[model samples]
Target: MGLLMFYEYLSRIEALIEKHDDIGLHNYLDAMHAADIAEVLENLESDEQRQVFGLLTDEKATEVLEELNSDDFSELIKALTYEKKVTLLDLMSQDDIVDKLNELPESRQKEIIAFLDYEDAADVKDLLLYEEDTAGGIMTKDYVSIQKDYSIYYAIETLRAIAPDAETIYYIYVVDDAERLVGVISLRELIIASPNRSVESVMNENVITVNINDDQEEVARIVSKYDLLAVPVVDNGNVMHGIITIDDVLDVIEEEATEDIYKFAGTSDEEVYEHDDTLFDRVKNSVRSRLPWLVITIFGGLLSAKVLASYQTTISANASLAMFMPLLAGMGGNVGTQSSTITVRNIATHMIEGADILRTLIHEISVGMLVGMFCAIIVGTAALFMHAEYHIAIIVGISMCANMVTAATIGTIVPLIFKRIGVDPAVASAPFITTTIDLTGLTIYFTLATMMIANL
Candidate 1:
């Protein structure tokens, strides 16, 4: 619905609730998507949120809970009675239950876990042992698996019995007696195969799987690379654990991309502020996110000042050199930022591997050389037009070319070095790159002025 339409619905909802019209409230909410219902609940006051949420059927409640953010989901569940909370928890997927419980306080998490059946509780507890950003943590325990030796008829029968509880039936995993995943077969294959055929006969033996401890980003990369709907997670012995579905991988992609964007802007945490947040809240969060980066930037400025201070004699002798300093640094920083962003993106997307780094660096340097030559001619001509001395114009031209080449080389190498050392390439963000370029570009420009200016 449009904003005005949603507000209209919200007013009607509040009116019905005030009248204690349970039937009217349920009828109104039941027709909306879970996401729309979540949007409405988020706009409501705490008490109103609870009242509107309470009107949802048990199944609809589960759907809405899944659609809500971590904070909103926790708040909604916390408002429920103990029995009602447990009932909702029981209806959720194992991964969702673990995620929700993790958001709660330690004591509350224990209390909620106690309400689960022994098996479901054990599964959730085991899932909790994995890091939140790992493949094991995101994978769901609900999937269809069949013994490799089983006949097609038996597999079909087995699927009929377990399909209701499985998260996906598109790909059926083939396991051994020990529940180690050995192959994978599509449901389409199973349906077309003769009843007498063994699952092992049709299953693809070259199954692609991820280790439980693999990073979620790596999991996403694998799923995306193979165009898979789901990839199975396994232990050291290849024992089947769970499957990471495409939907979860899509979430990981969005989260990682957002994180990279924030880091590029010098923000620390990965939060994207909502439009509905209060002004004070946004200001507070904005300060919290940007303060550390600003502190670093402040120090960088002081360092640049110190560099300028050291060149006092050089600038005092040749005022024209000072005039050109900003131009040199500005061009270098712009070029460096461009190179670093491309390198970081290529690394993150796996387009450039370790073996490809050397070639990539060479290509960047070649482009840098071409860019530097073009910029040098333009800047030198501009300096001459501004009535600068011939020697000063020549020095500015040479400095611009040298700075651009150096800046581009540094930008290309820094991200590769960070990745080689197992750090996120995005940590060498735009702000950081620009600062480095500024200091180096200034130093290079002054040193060239000292050498090339005849009066100096």
Candidate 2:
């Protein structure tokens, strides 16, 4: 349905729930997709969310809970009764089950674990052992696999038996006698091929797999780079453990994007709209993320102050120099930030490798020089019009050109340096780049001002 129609439908559902005060309203809400239901719940107040969620069937509740963001998921979990929580946990997939458990307190997790079925409990425990941002944590153990010795007919029959629980049936894995992943076959191939054909004969042996300990970001990169639907996970023994589906990789991509944005804005990785967090808790999370950058900016400001102080006598003699200082610094900062952002993004996407780093830096420096020369002409002409001394205009022009070159070089280099040191370039780039530009711009401006004005 169109968005307008969906909104109208939700409005009608809200009115119906208010008017009827019955189970029919609950049934009407349950019939919608989980994503749609999540949207509806998000629009409601906290108390209203609790009330609506309480009325949902356990299955519907599980679907909606998974669809919600982490903050909303925590709130929903808190709102649910102990029995309802157990029911929701039982209904969710193993990966989701572990996610919810990790979000809860240790005592709550222990209590929930006691109620889980042995198989599910074991899977959850195994998943919890891996880092939250690793391949093992994101992969689902539920997938259709068969021995390579099995004929197409046998594989199809086996798949049909377990299709209900599998996350996807697009790719069927073929395992050797040792239960090692040997090959992969698509559902389309299975349906087209003769029934008697052995899986080993038909399957593609050049299977792409990842180690269970691989970083989730690396997993997402591989999936996106190869345009893969799913990637197999293997242990040290090369035994197939689980598969990471495209949907899970998409979640990783989103999480990475959110993290990058937060780092860019000098915020923490925690949810910004946490419902139960106290004001102090919120402040603590935000402050910790922001303070380091603020500290760095302070040092940058200090450097600018020192540079200006060194040229105080010259600036006092020639007032025009002070007017252009702000303009020069601002432009340099803008150019630096732009270069840093581009380089960081390229590195993150794996488009730029370590080997290409020097070449990229040199290219950026050359581009900066060209841009600086153009900006210098404009600023110099403006300075000439504003000031009587031709030497002062030339000083301003030379400083502008030098500042731009410095800005671009520092901007491009900072991110590369961070990446080499195993730091996320995005997180380290912005504040440092701006700070470097500010300091360098001021130094250039003041030195030029001192040279021209002192001579005059």
Best by lDDT: 1
User: Residue by residue across 297-370, what tens digits does model 2's lDDT show?
Assistant: 89988887887888788878878777787888888988898888888888889878867888888888988899
Off by over 4 Å in 2: 1-14, 42-51, 54-59, 69-90, 453-456
| Cα-based TM-score, every candidate | 0.91, 0.91
TM-score of model 2 relative to the true fold? 0.91
lDDT of 1 by residue, 50-80 (tens): 9899989999999889877666887888788
Poorest 10 consecutive residues of model 2 by lDDT? 267-276
Q: List the residue pairs that clash in candidate 2.
A: none
Separately for all candidates shown, the number of backbone clashes (residues 3 or more apart, or on different chains) is 0, 0
Q: How does model 1 fare in lDDT?
A: 0.87
Backbone clashes (count) for model 2: 0
Per-model CA lDDT versus the true structure? 0.87, 0.83
